[model samples]
Target: MAADCEAWLNANPVEAEDLSDSFISAEEDNGGSGGTNKNIHNEINGNWLSSSSNNLHEARLKAKAKRRLRKNSSRDSGRGDSLSDNGEVARGTPIAPTSPKSKLLDRKSRMGKGRGLPKKGGAGGKGVWGRSGEVYELVEVDKKDPNFDEDQENCVYETVVPPLDERDFEKTVTPIVQEYFEHGDTNEVAELLADLNLGPMRSEVPSLAVSLALEAKASQRELTSRLLVDLCGSVLSHSDMESSFDKLLRDLPDLVLDTPGAPQLVGQFIARAVSDQILSKSYIEGYKGKVDCEHARAALDRAAVLLKMSLGGLRIDTHWGTGGGQRPVIQLIKEMNLLLKEYILSGDGKEAERCLRDLEVPHFHHEFVYEAIVMVLESRGEKTFKMVLQLLKSLSLSSIITVDQMRRGYERVYMDIDEINIDVPLAYFILEQFVDKSFRMGIIGVKLRDQCPHRNRKRLVSEGDGGVVKFERY
Candidate 1:
């Protein structure tokens, strides 16, 4: 019985216990004592039944199991009754032998869940490295036998990505797509490319390129608006794709914007353009006058924030275009001023200060700092002015001190205008600078209304002050 069980284990593989169970059960019914039970006749075909049929019953069980086996059958089908070696399918059919591996892969994948390894073969002691492309092998269910390797046999795959056409259209297509994007003409491009194929798109053109484009569309829409899109074509020159690209990039909001790296690409282009102007600074700036490379810098900034870009990636290679003698410090201050104003309008003092810190324009002089102080102090309340002074004097910019300054300033000048017994006219002009920065320099003055232009503007003049006069129209 031990030998029999061992034989069964070897031939049938104890791992497939259900098969073992079936054979054992049928054998017990036939009486293991070398005789066939009458019950066996009805359960199995009678042609092989024997009076001394324990052997016959065993033969029947084996035969039934072989017939039911899912693996290769070339094993025992010799005289149309006996199996040949290695249990293969009968010759002449194209179907290959059904190994334990191929069968389970088919079954498991059908369940909508995928499995990593197969049940047998291509691993462990004997049959591993069995085929090419079998990079690694895994162990069997009990870690008993070699199980699976994702070799050519196991990991059958189908490559569907269309091969890149080295010369056909990529060069032409890449520029066209970029240009269209720069021009804010994606809708036009999409329309033109509608129903178009890369050569010829399959119905599966749910293919990669199309899918990527689809994923990119929603973000593009959110970042772009019709007004800004028009600005791209109008404010930015069509010939300089960098201009349009930079414009679009700058329009992105500080929060909830497009992918971070996006600006880097735009920035690279702008940097290149600026470098070009720099390389040709004599001739180009002579013609263009004070080149607005600010757009380019902004594009680079957007790209850096969006793409998390590295400076090494930029390809700036331009010679000077103009103002060879003038340093960019003044221009940098102007840019910083614009940014600062926008930051204030957006109610983000923190970012405005950071911008001031990062300003690296070589021309930034003490005068610029002094100008900044005058502008800040004159336009803001006395208390607010003090806070600006404190922030400048502080070793490191601190938020707490800045807040305290603002609170004191607002309370002092804004809340108690009447106590000063000051000239109402001078007071009106003095306070109005908070509304328009130019008021600080006496270049222009502002009117105060509680609401904005379309609505009411804040009233800069104090209540019951005879000097109060409403501000003028735009």
Candidate 2:
């Protein structure tokens, strides 16, 4: 019966890929499942229409109708290429369902040996066991391993372009000096210099900058001067005076001589430095000597020329015009002395000491000590009296005032203080302080012992009950 059915199917093949849908559609088109089921009903003696069989047949009819509708739409849309003439699904066509409950049905009804059966496992194709329980074997794919080879050739390369000198110069040096000119801080400039390995050549930076500025057009000259002024000021104001100030002092004369209008600017700076006590009187004096020596040498050279010209002289009258020849040295010395004397006279021991550090003459300490004592004694203020003695002690320790200088300064101060209505015996308090400081310092030079004024000996020995006056001379 199956062969006869197959022969009939071969004679009339379905256009759609699903053969089960063809059978269901043919039965439905003939009448319905009711007609076919009626034949089975009669064959089963009216008991053929069981609830399960009826339900199965109804689900099959619904699935067949859905397939027939899909096939009609595909044919109208020109998608009938998915159907084969021999009732096989074309490659890439989806498998159609047998019924809505296809998943619940046994595998026997869902899959069978047919033209639309899934392809067997070959060359990595996916496969399942056949209904007879034959297993599909899995195929292994071969892969090619990668091959690596190293190629090494001459790779060293040199820059074909010349080294950029200006760029490097701008990077390493120009920016630092430019910033220094913008901000007048020597320590910052020094740090920058150290970073660039130009620390030791610091003075050169400003000198070079000034030269460049001078060579620039007229419009930039003022800017050059201003930046140079700031740079020089920073160098002078640096706290590391031993290095910064001392080096500048050595380099300054040459800088001033070489650069035009430099002496005037430098002269102004020196004046400011002295006024502010940023530099010592000794430095000012040395600067003065340099200027004077240069001037004297120039003058002598002119005189020698004049003397030589006089041998053929009708008369050569050459007028000497003063230009950049003025020296501030002598004036600076007067200022130093005036400030020092004022501090001493005011009984300001601290200020006097500050001035004392700048004094060009060490012998002048005796004068300062004497004047300080006299100021204190005359004021007769207890604080002033103590300040003078402390100042003298400080001077002695610094070796600025020797034991002998103190002895003489003491006698002179005592006599002056005594003449001001201070008790003659009270004057011994001052002398006693000197003697004690001298002894404490291990200075027993005969000048101190011998210079003790004969008349003040009695005053020095006289006892007093004042808080500071009564201490023993020893």
Cα lDDT computed for each candidate against the true fold: 0.40, 0.47
Candidate no. 2 TM-score: 0.25
Name the top lDDT candidate. 2
Question: Per-prediction TM-score, please?
Answer: 0.20, 0.25
Predicted structure 1: lDDT = 0.40
Model 1: ten consecutive residues of lowest lDDT: 202-211
Model 1 has how many clashing residue pairs?
Answer: 48
Model 2 residue 12 CA deviation (Å) reads 99
Model 2 agreement with the true structure over 266-331: per-residue lDDT tens digits: 333333333334445455445333544443334333433444454565232212111111214455
- Which candidate should be chosen as best, given TM-score against the real structure? 2
Residue-pair clashes per candidate:
48, 0
